[model samples]
Target: MMYPPPESQSLKTLLPETPILLMGSGPVPVPQEVATASSIVISHLGETMKKIVARVQLMAQYVFQTKTTKIFGISGPSSAGMEMAIGSLLWPGRKVLVLNLGTFSARFAEMARGVGAEVKEILPQGLAPIYIEQVREAFEKDSFDVLTIVQGETSCGVKNIHLKEIVELAKSHGVLTIVDAVCTLSTMPLPMDEWGIDIVFVGGQKGLSAVPGISLIAISENTFQFISNRTQAMPHWCLDPRRAFKFWGLGEYHYTAPVTGILALHEGLRLICEEGLEARFERHLKCSSALQNSLEAMGFSLFTPAEFRLNSVVAINNLSNVNTKELISLLIKECHVEISGAFGLDIIRVGQMGEQSRFENIERVIRALAFGYGKFGHKLDLESGLKVLNISRDSGKK
Candidate 1:
């Protein structure tokens, strides 16, 4: 039977045989250590699981660069992490100010509205990062119980470079801050504790380089106390921080945990620790900077401005001469590399997180893109692009 067999075939179709380079928004290639750990099945309530969780929590602290110990993993993608934060802090009659910069930030607004919170969103009118002035303008308009922002807006590669200041501004107004660190968490320096963010959530598949289904959240002590003191009961039982803390914080069982997923995440975090955050951040910067330089030399324009560009997932304008959908398909079919298209914008995203941050991997994807552009009758300066990548790599050795 053919792999991913036709819908007419049985449900137990074989997995695809060839490995395609995942250079899209997320679910990037997992490191060898993470892959090995995921293959082993263990009891969730066993002593072994406890040992792994213990180490993972410490390693996660280093990755987040946060002093908070109220960290735990939820059993889904990053969205699950988002839901947990919302359910724990937001309630009926509460007011939330959402900084709606792009697709991902807009989701926070929708989730806040779902929680029965009075949601007011500031939809910035450009592809640039939300300025401190914009945030200040919103603050002058009204007060909010909670302020939601995406540190790195993945949909457009826009990084809120003013996040630390914005959160400070909200804090001064007695507003709790929840940052969606999904695309930026491990790829860049977040410094959650220093930034005084109440809650920061991330997915395992992105910067963590683990498989999806296991997500993590970092909660400040103040945030935990706020959740505990709230009169309104948490709407979500499974995502409730009170119950989740009992399991991951207090070493008591709240529910059957995703053992395999935790193991994978633990290994992923271990890799981050082994590499050291400073080294990891530098590596990501070099690779991403090289990628941007090469793309520009190849005649592609970056959608996000250089000053506020996100290094994790890059957004580039679609070549006017090439059909983006067809180019993406050709890259997958002929070059075995996968990228992502925007929701409503004429741009394509290339992910540069975890294993994808390596120079060799970046080179591979650049070559694949050049090949695709060539097939579409637009011959990019491939040699110049490669030279730029080489120069960046060489400069990093200094």
Candidate 2:
């Protein structure tokens, strides 16, 4: 006369639990202040009437190290940022050479093609980082008007390290550089001006730790000139950067932006400056290193190579032993932690930026993983994990 213990008794039988950690896409959890900040007028003229737009632009200038040209809040998600930036600058019949390391880079190439540009994608030879030599060969053979790179290719755990060199090379050839820094900006130091990056886009969800509605696009003066000279009509209405500048600048916006998102992003930028960029980046490094070490110690292979691993998120190979869906469910229900599993890539991405970058929390996450797997009849060493986790946390700090 006994009853079943519970559906989740064996990890295999449990319903998927909500990830407690919530680190999957950008537009991550925003700080309370972002919501609390009173939104100003949404009218194009209203932008100049109040200090909100000015403050946001100033903060961006401080954080990104770029002189104020213009800033605008587009309505769509982060992808919209790329679209707006690319749509504004790419002209029909111009040749564009893309550095496609992952999904986002492929998206960039598609967007370029949509604008009627002749596109060529440079696919990496293997699972390694995109070698500088490969890029050099591509540049030597092709004369492209635009070059695109994803700074931290979240789809694959490859961070494009030769971005500076690529940007310089593009400049030498009179090719405009477009960068998707959606996952890299705040987690890593991005001195856009120094790097010679022409057009850069970042999402609020990733490094910014703000809500998803706000996407930032910063353009260099040269890129601005390129956009001004484009002959074809831009496909999207709200995505027109020149119209945005008119609104965010002295003129009224030809269209409206997401007013609330702009408010939140302003405060988010303030928080980042208050925290100090170097300290924030160091914290991110420490957390990522710890997570990588813990996973490796527990017999998991990292999808990202040692040299090109991104700071904000680490991708762990699923391997043969574990069912990723079951593992995520157990960790969520039993541990109240959230980690993201990549599609197409057999890996789970753990975030370590903003509020989630706590040492104890990272250690707790490892423990939960250990316990979660143990429940599934997998033998795990909880005792030895303690030693390995500590070593990882310690080494990552240095």
Residue-wise C-alpha lDDT for candidate 2, range 1-398, written one tens digit per residue: 89867644666455454435665544355567875753554543563434777787778776676884755566677799999977887768788888998788899898998988899988887875566788788888878888888888887778888888888888888888888888887788878898888888887777877777678888777677767777788777788887777766654646665677777788889999898889888878877776777677776678878987876777877656778888887787778876777768778777766666667767777787778777776665656666776876666344
Output the worst ten-in-a-row residue range by lDDT, candidate 1.
Answer: 9-18
Q: What's the lDDT for candidate 2? A: 0.76
Backbone atom clashes (below 3 Å) for every candidate: 0, 6
Using Cα atoms with residue i matched to residue i, what is each candidate's TM-score against the true structure? 0.95, 0.88
* Global lDDT scores for all candidate models: 0.89, 0.76
RMSD of each: 3.1, 7.1
- In the predicted model 1, the residue pairs found to clash are none
Model 2: residue 237 alpha-carbon error in angstroms? 1.3
Quick one: best lDDT, which candidate? 1
111-154, model 1: which lDDT tens digit per residue?
88888999998877677777889889988988889999998998
Error of 2 at 110 (Å): 1.4
